[model samples]
Target: VFFHNALPFVGFGFLDNAIMIAAGTQIELSIGVVLGISTMAAAALGNLVSDLAGLGLAGYVEALASRLGLSIPDLTPKQADMWQTRLSAHLGKAIGVTIGCILGMFPLLFFGDEEEKLEEKN
Candidate 1:
Protein backbone atom coordinates (compact mmCIF):
# COMPACT_ATOMS: atom_id res chain seq x y z
CA VAL A 1 0.00 0.00 0.00
CA PHE A 2 2.85 2.35 0.83
CA PHE A 3 4.46 1.92 -2.53
CA HIS A 4 1.09 1.74 -4.21
CA ASN A 5 0.33 5.34 -3.33
CA ALA A 6 3.41 6.56 -5.13
CA LEU A 7 2.34 5.56 -8.63
CA PRO A 8 0.79 8.86 -9.78
CA PHE A 9 3.93 10.81 -9.10
CA VAL A 10 5.82 8.39 -11.32
CA GLY A 11 3.20 8.82 -14.05
CA PHE A 12 3.39 12.58 -13.91
CA GLY A 13 6.79 12.78 -15.53
CA PHE A 14 6.09 11.57 -19.07
CA LEU A 15 6.07 15.03 -20.69
CA ASP A 16 9.33 15.89 -19.06
CA ASN A 17 10.87 12.73 -20.42
CA ALA A 18 9.59 13.46 -23.90
CA ILE A 19 11.07 16.93 -23.82
CA MET A 20 14.37 15.67 -22.45
CA ILE A 21 14.53 12.84 -24.93
CA ALA A 22 14.00 15.39 -27.67
CA ALA A 23 16.79 17.39 -26.07
CA GLY A 24 19.01 14.33 -26.24
CA THR A 25 19.22 13.36 -22.60
CA GLN A 26 20.53 9.90 -21.89
CA ILE A 27 18.18 7.79 -19.80
CA GLU A 28 19.60 4.80 -17.99
CA LEU A 29 16.91 2.80 -16.23
CA SER A 30 19.50 0.13 -15.44
CA ILE A 31 21.11 2.39 -12.87
CA GLY A 32 20.12 2.09 -9.23
CA VAL A 33 19.04 5.69 -8.60
CA VAL A 34 16.81 5.85 -11.66
CA LEU A 35 14.20 3.71 -10.00
CA GLY A 36 14.78 4.70 -6.40
CA ILE A 37 12.81 7.13 -4.24
CA SER A 38 14.55 9.89 -6.16
CA THR A 39 12.76 8.77 -9.29
CA MET A 40 9.43 9.00 -7.52
CA ALA A 41 10.26 12.42 -6.23
CA ALA A 42 11.39 13.49 -9.67
CA ALA A 43 8.15 12.26 -11.17
CA ALA A 44 6.02 14.18 -8.68
CA LEU A 45 8.07 17.26 -9.30
CA GLY A 46 7.69 16.85 -13.03
CA ASN A 47 3.95 16.55 -12.68
CA LEU A 48 3.88 19.67 -10.56
CA VAL A 49 5.82 21.66 -13.11
CA SER A 50 3.99 20.22 -16.07
CA ASP A 51 0.63 20.97 -14.52
CA LEU A 52 1.70 24.55 -14.16
CA ALA A 53 3.93 24.99 -17.19
CA GLY A 54 1.95 22.94 -19.64
CA LEU A 55 -0.75 25.57 -19.68
CA GLY A 56 1.71 28.35 -20.16
CA LEU A 57 3.70 26.40 -22.72
CA ALA A 58 0.62 25.74 -24.76
CA GLY A 59 -0.54 29.33 -24.67
CA TYR A 60 2.91 30.68 -25.24
CA VAL A 61 3.46 28.52 -28.26
CA GLU A 62 0.06 29.37 -29.60
CA ALA A 63 0.74 33.04 -29.15
CA LEU A 64 4.08 32.66 -30.84
CA ALA A 65 2.48 30.85 -33.68
CA SER A 66 -0.10 33.56 -34.09
CA ARG A 67 2.38 36.39 -33.73
CA LEU A 68 5.04 34.97 -36.00
CA GLY A 69 2.55 33.27 -38.30
CA LEU A 70 4.76 30.22 -38.07
CA SER A 71 3.90 26.61 -37.38
CA ILE A 72 4.72 25.55 -33.84
CA PRO A 73 5.73 22.05 -34.88
CA ASP A 74 8.15 23.36 -37.45
CA LEU A 75 10.83 24.59 -35.11
CA THR A 76 14.28 24.80 -36.66
CA PRO A 77 17.20 22.83 -35.31
CA LYS A 78 18.51 25.79 -33.37
CA GLN A 79 15.05 26.66 -32.17
CA ALA A 80 14.47 23.12 -31.05
CA ASP A 81 17.79 23.04 -29.22
CA MET A 82 17.13 26.38 -27.62
CA TRP A 83 13.67 25.48 -26.45
CA GLN A 84 14.81 22.10 -25.23
CA THR A 85 17.67 23.66 -23.31
CA ARG A 86 15.41 26.28 -21.81
CA LEU A 87 12.73 23.81 -20.82
CA SER A 88 15.28 21.37 -19.44
CA ALA A 89 17.26 23.99 -17.59
CA HIS A 90 14.23 25.24 -15.75
CA LEU A 91 12.30 21.99 -15.52
CA GLY A 92 14.87 19.18 -15.50
CA LYS A 93 14.00 17.68 -12.13
CA ALA A 94 10.33 18.06 -12.76
CA ILE A 95 10.73 16.51 -16.20
CA GLY A 96 12.76 13.59 -14.89
CA VAL A 97 10.24 13.15 -12.09
CA THR A 98 7.42 13.19 -14.62
CA ILE A 99 9.13 10.53 -16.69
CA GLY A 100 9.74 8.36 -13.65
CA CYS A 101 6.13 8.71 -12.53
CA ILE A 102 4.76 7.70 -15.94
CA LEU A 103 6.96 4.64 -16.17
CA GLY A 104 6.53 3.88 -12.50
CA MET A 105 2.74 4.02 -12.65
CA PHE A 106 2.26 1.06 -15.00
CA PRO A 107 3.43 -1.58 -12.56
CA LEU A 108 1.27 -0.23 -9.78
CA LEU A 109 -1.83 -0.18 -11.98
CA PHE A 110 -1.31 -3.66 -13.38
CA PHE A 111 -0.40 -5.17 -10.04
CA GLY A 112 -2.55 -3.15 -7.68
CA ASP A 113 -5.46 -4.80 -5.89
CA GLU A 114 -8.78 -4.55 -7.67
CA GLU A 115 -10.78 -5.18 -4.50
CA GLU A 116 -11.89 -2.20 -2.50
CA LYS A 117 -11.72 -2.02 1.28
CA LEU A 118 -14.66 -0.74 3.24
CA GLU A 119 -14.29 1.24 6.41
CA GLU A 120 -16.22 0.40 9.53
CA LYS A 121 -19.57 2.19 9.79
CA ASN A 122 -21.11 3.03 13.10
Candidate 2:
Protein backbone atom coordinates (compact mmCIF):
# COMPACT_ATOMS: atom_id res chain seq x y z
CA VAL A 1 0.00 0.00 0.00
CA PHE A 2 2.85 2.40 0.78
CA PHE A 3 4.48 1.75 -2.58
CA HIS A 4 1.16 2.20 -4.36
CA ASN A 5 1.16 5.88 -3.43
CA ALA A 6 4.48 6.21 -5.19
CA LEU A 7 2.81 5.22 -8.46
CA PRO A 8 2.11 8.85 -9.24
CA PHE A 9 5.81 9.60 -9.26
CA VAL A 10 6.56 6.62 -11.46
CA GLY A 11 3.72 7.53 -13.81
CA PHE A 12 5.00 11.05 -14.31
CA GLY A 13 8.49 9.78 -15.04
CA PHE A 14 7.04 7.71 -17.87
CA LEU A 15 5.06 10.69 -19.09
CA ASP A 16 8.16 12.82 -19.62
CA ASN A 17 10.06 9.90 -21.08
CA ALA A 18 8.50 10.57 -24.48
CA ILE A 19 11.25 13.10 -25.05
CA MET A 20 13.85 10.42 -24.52
CA ILE A 21 11.93 7.66 -26.28
CA ALA A 22 12.04 9.38 -29.66
CA ALA A 23 9.20 11.40 -31.14
CA GLY A 24 8.31 8.73 -33.66
CA THR A 25 7.34 6.30 -30.91
CA GLN A 26 4.90 8.69 -29.28
CA ILE A 27 2.37 7.81 -31.97
CA GLU A 28 2.88 4.11 -31.37
CA LEU A 29 1.85 4.24 -27.69
CA SER A 30 -0.86 5.80 -25.61
CA ILE A 31 0.26 8.59 -23.28
CA GLY A 32 -0.18 6.82 -19.93
CA VAL A 33 0.81 3.21 -20.57
CA VAL A 34 4.53 2.40 -20.27
CA LEU A 35 4.53 -0.75 -22.40
CA GLY A 36 3.20 1.39 -25.22
CA ILE A 37 -0.24 0.77 -26.56
CA SER A 38 0.07 -1.66 -29.45
CA THR A 39 -3.33 -0.99 -30.91
CA MET A 40 -3.66 1.28 -33.91
CA ALA A 41 -6.06 3.62 -32.11
CA ALA A 42 -3.64 4.64 -29.39
CA ALA A 43 -4.38 8.37 -29.41
CA ALA A 44 -8.11 7.93 -29.02
CA LEU A 45 -7.49 5.39 -26.27
CA GLY A 46 -5.17 7.77 -24.41
CA ASN A 47 -6.40 9.69 -21.41
CA LEU A 48 -7.43 13.33 -21.30
CA VAL A 49 -3.88 14.22 -20.30
CA SER A 50 -3.51 16.93 -22.92
CA ASP A 51 -6.49 18.80 -21.54
CA LEU A 52 -5.09 18.62 -18.03
CA ALA A 53 -1.76 19.89 -19.23
CA GLY A 54 -3.36 22.63 -21.29
CA LEU A 55 -5.26 23.93 -18.30
CA GLY A 56 -2.08 23.98 -16.21
CA LEU A 57 -0.06 25.73 -18.90
CA ALA A 58 -2.86 28.13 -19.77
CA GLY A 59 -3.06 29.38 -16.20
CA TYR A 60 0.65 30.10 -16.09
CA VAL A 61 0.63 31.68 -19.53
CA GLU A 62 -2.38 33.80 -18.65
CA ALA A 63 -0.70 35.02 -15.48
CA LEU A 64 2.52 35.95 -17.23
CA ALA A 65 0.68 37.50 -20.12
CA SER A 66 -1.29 39.65 -17.70
CA ARG A 67 1.89 40.89 -16.06
CA LEU A 68 3.27 41.73 -19.48
CA GLY A 69 0.02 43.48 -20.47
CA LEU A 70 -0.63 40.94 -23.22
CA SER A 71 -4.31 40.09 -23.60
CA ILE A 72 -5.82 36.61 -23.53
CA PRO A 73 -8.90 36.27 -25.71
CA ASP A 74 -10.89 33.88 -23.54
CA LEU A 75 -10.47 34.52 -19.85
CA THR A 76 -13.95 33.22 -19.18
CA PRO A 77 -14.09 29.64 -17.86
CA LYS A 78 -16.21 28.13 -20.64
CA GLN A 79 -14.23 29.70 -23.44
CA ALA A 80 -10.97 28.94 -21.69
CA ASP A 81 -11.81 25.25 -21.68
CA MET A 82 -12.41 25.31 -25.39
CA TRP A 83 -9.13 27.10 -25.83
CA GLN A 84 -7.35 24.42 -23.81
CA THR A 85 -8.58 21.66 -26.12
CA ARG A 86 -7.64 23.53 -29.23
CA LEU A 87 -4.23 24.35 -27.83
CA SER A 88 -3.53 20.80 -26.70
CA ALA A 89 -4.76 19.29 -29.92
CA HIS A 90 -2.54 21.64 -31.85
CA LEU A 91 0.37 20.77 -29.56
CA GLY A 92 0.15 17.09 -30.56
CA LYS A 93 1.15 14.09 -28.42
CA ALA A 94 4.92 14.30 -28.64
CA ILE A 95 5.42 17.85 -27.41
CA GLY A 96 2.31 18.08 -25.27
CA VAL A 97 2.92 14.93 -23.23
CA THR A 98 6.58 15.75 -22.62
CA ILE A 99 5.83 19.19 -21.24
CA GLY A 100 2.82 17.98 -19.26
CA CYS A 101 4.71 15.07 -17.72
CA ILE A 102 7.49 17.32 -16.43
CA LEU A 103 4.98 19.79 -15.04
CA GLY A 104 2.98 17.01 -13.40
CA MET A 105 6.07 15.88 -11.48
CA PHE A 106 7.02 19.41 -10.38
CA PRO A 107 4.33 19.66 -7.71
CA LEU A 108 5.36 16.34 -6.17
CA LEU A 109 8.79 17.75 -5.38
CA PHE A 110 7.43 20.56 -3.21
CA PHE A 111 4.04 19.32 -2.09
CA GLY A 112 4.04 15.56 -1.49
CA ASP A 113 4.37 14.22 2.06
CA GLU A 114 7.88 13.12 2.94
CA GLU A 115 6.78 9.81 4.42
CA GLU A 116 9.98 8.05 3.49
CA LYS A 117 12.09 10.53 5.41
CA LEU A 118 9.94 10.03 8.52
CA GLU A 119 10.30 6.27 8.29
CA GLU A 120 14.07 6.57 8.06
CA LYS A 121 14.25 8.38 11.42
CA ASN A 122 12.63 5.52 13.35
Candidate 3:
Protein backbone atom coordinates (compact mmCIF):
# COMPACT_ATOMS: atom_id res chain seq x y z
CA VAL A 1 0.00 0.00 0.00
CA PHE A 2 2.84 2.37 0.81
CA PHE A 3 4.51 1.49 -2.48
CA HIS A 4 1.25 2.17 -4.32
CA ASN A 5 0.91 5.54 -2.66
CA ALA A 6 4.52 6.47 -3.37
CA LEU A 7 4.45 5.63 -7.08
CA PRO A 8 2.99 8.96 -8.06
CA PHE A 9 5.67 10.92 -6.22
CA VAL A 10 8.28 8.81 -7.98
CA GLY A 11 6.60 9.53 -11.28
CA PHE A 12 6.56 13.23 -10.48
CA GLY A 13 10.28 13.17 -9.78
CA PHE A 14 10.94 11.62 -13.17
CA LEU A 15 8.79 14.24 -14.84
CA ASP A 16 10.75 16.97 -13.07
CA ASN A 17 13.99 15.48 -14.27
CA ALA A 18 12.73 15.36 -17.84
CA ILE A 19 11.59 18.95 -17.65
CA MET A 20 14.92 20.08 -16.25
CA ILE A 21 16.77 18.37 -19.06
CA ALA A 22 14.48 19.86 -21.68
CA ALA A 23 14.89 23.33 -20.22
CA GLY A 24 18.67 23.00 -20.20
CA THR A 25 18.82 21.81 -23.81
CA GLN A 26 16.44 24.47 -25.17
CA ILE A 27 14.89 21.73 -27.27
CA GLU A 28 12.56 22.61 -30.13
CA LEU A 29 8.85 22.50 -29.43
CA SER A 30 8.44 19.24 -31.32
CA ILE A 31 11.25 17.62 -29.36
CA GLY A 32 9.84 18.92 -26.11
CA VAL A 33 6.51 17.28 -26.92
CA VAL A 34 8.29 14.04 -27.71
CA LEU A 35 10.28 14.19 -24.47
CA GLY A 36 7.13 14.83 -22.47
CA ILE A 37 5.41 11.84 -24.01
CA SER A 38 8.39 9.61 -23.41
CA THR A 39 8.64 10.79 -19.81
CA MET A 40 4.98 10.01 -19.22
CA ALA A 41 5.43 6.57 -20.71
CA ALA A 42 8.37 5.92 -18.45
CA ALA A 43 6.43 7.05 -15.41
CA ALA A 44 3.50 4.79 -16.25
CA LEU A 45 5.84 1.86 -16.76
CA GLY A 46 7.49 2.56 -13.41
CA ASN A 47 4.12 2.61 -11.64
CA LEU A 48 3.11 -0.65 -13.27
CA VAL A 49 6.34 -2.25 -12.12
CA SER A 50 5.71 -1.07 -8.56
CA ASP A 51 2.17 -2.47 -8.62
CA LEU A 52 3.39 -5.83 -9.84
CA ALA A 53 6.04 -5.90 -7.13
CA GLY A 54 3.43 -5.22 -4.46
CA LEU A 55 1.22 -8.03 -5.74
CA GLY A 56 4.18 -10.38 -5.71
CA LEU A 57 5.06 -9.44 -2.14
CA ALA A 58 1.48 -10.00 -1.02
CA GLY A 59 1.45 -13.41 -2.67
CA TYR A 60 4.69 -14.31 -0.96
CA VAL A 61 3.32 -13.41 2.46
CA GLU A 62 0.19 -15.44 1.82
CA ALA A 63 2.26 -18.39 0.76
CA LEU A 64 4.50 -18.09 3.83
CA ALA A 65 1.49 -17.96 6.12
CA SER A 66 0.02 -21.04 4.50
CA ARG A 67 3.27 -22.96 4.78
CA LEU A 68 3.43 -22.12 8.48
CA GLY A 69 -0.02 -23.61 9.12
CA LEU A 70 -1.29 -20.27 10.30
CA SER A 71 -5.05 -20.21 10.63
CA ILE A 72 -6.02 -17.10 8.79
CA PRO A 73 -9.51 -15.94 9.48
CA ASP A 74 -11.82 -16.16 6.53
CA LEU A 75 -13.17 -12.74 5.62
CA THR A 76 -16.92 -12.36 5.41
CA PRO A 77 -18.39 -11.25 2.12
CA LYS A 78 -18.65 -7.67 3.35
CA GLN A 79 -15.09 -7.67 4.59
CA ALA A 80 -13.89 -9.12 1.30
CA ASP A 81 -15.74 -6.40 -0.57
CA MET A 82 -14.23 -3.71 1.63
CA TRP A 83 -10.74 -5.05 1.06
CA GLN A 84 -11.30 -4.99 -2.67
CA THR A 85 -12.49 -1.41 -2.42
CA ARG A 86 -9.34 -0.32 -0.59
CA LEU A 87 -7.15 -2.16 -3.06
CA SER A 88 -8.93 -0.48 -5.93
CA ALA A 89 -8.40 2.89 -4.29
CA HIS A 90 -4.67 2.32 -4.30
CA LEU A 91 -4.83 1.07 -7.88
CA GLY A 92 -6.57 4.28 -8.87
CA LYS A 93 -3.73 6.28 -7.32
CA ALA A 94 -1.22 4.51 -9.54
CA ILE A 95 -3.36 5.29 -12.58
CA GLY A 96 -3.67 8.89 -11.48
CA VAL A 97 0.11 9.20 -11.33
CA THR A 98 0.32 8.14 -14.98
CA ILE A 99 -2.30 10.67 -16.03
CA GLY A 100 -0.96 13.44 -13.81
CA CYS A 101 2.57 13.05 -15.12
CA ILE A 102 1.35 13.57 -18.68
CA LEU A 103 -0.66 16.60 -17.70
CA GLY A 104 2.06 18.12 -15.54
CA MET A 105 4.50 18.34 -18.45
CA PHE A 106 2.62 21.18 -20.09
CA PRO A 107 3.52 24.77 -19.22
CA LEU A 108 1.19 26.21 -16.57
CA LEU A 109 -0.01 22.67 -15.89
CA PHE A 110 2.69 21.70 -13.46
CA PHE A 111 2.31 22.49 -9.80
CA GLY A 112 4.85 25.00 -8.50
CA ASP A 113 7.10 24.47 -5.49
CA GLU A 114 4.92 26.74 -3.35
CA GLU A 115 1.90 24.57 -4.05
CA GLU A 116 3.83 21.47 -3.15
CA LYS A 117 5.11 23.02 0.03
CA LEU A 118 1.58 23.93 1.04
CA GLU A 119 0.46 20.41 0.34
CA GLU A 120 3.29 19.04 2.44
CA LYS A 121 2.36 21.31 5.32
CA ASN A 122 -1.19 20.07 5.16
Off by over 4 Å in 2: 1-40, 45-47, 71-122
Runs off by more than 4 Å, candidate 1: 1-36, 70-122
Candidate 3 lDDT, tens digit per residue, 9-43?
A: 44453454445434423332334346554535544
Ten consecutive residues with minimal summed lDDT in candidate 1? 113-122
Write candidate 1's Cα lDDT for 1-122 as tens digits. Answer: 11222232233354444443322211212221355434445445545555665555555543543565433244467875786655644464455455664664443343223212111210
Candidate 3 lDDT for residue 79? 70
By TM-score, the better pick of 1 and 3 is: 1
Q: Model 2: what TM-score?
A: 0.27
Ranking by lDDT: 3, 2, 1
Better of 1 and 3 by lDDT: 3
Whose TM-score is higher: candidate 2's or candidate 3's? 2
> What is the Cα-based TM-score of model 3?
0.25
| Local accuracy of candidate 2 as per-residue lDDT tens digits, 2-100 | 122223333444443333233223443324245545533443333344445444555564354356554434446675468665564445444544554
What ranges in model 3 sit over 4 Å off? 1-81, 107-122
Clashing pairs in 3: none
TM-score of each predicted structure versus truth: 0.27, 0.27, 0.25
Error of 2 at 15 (Å): 15
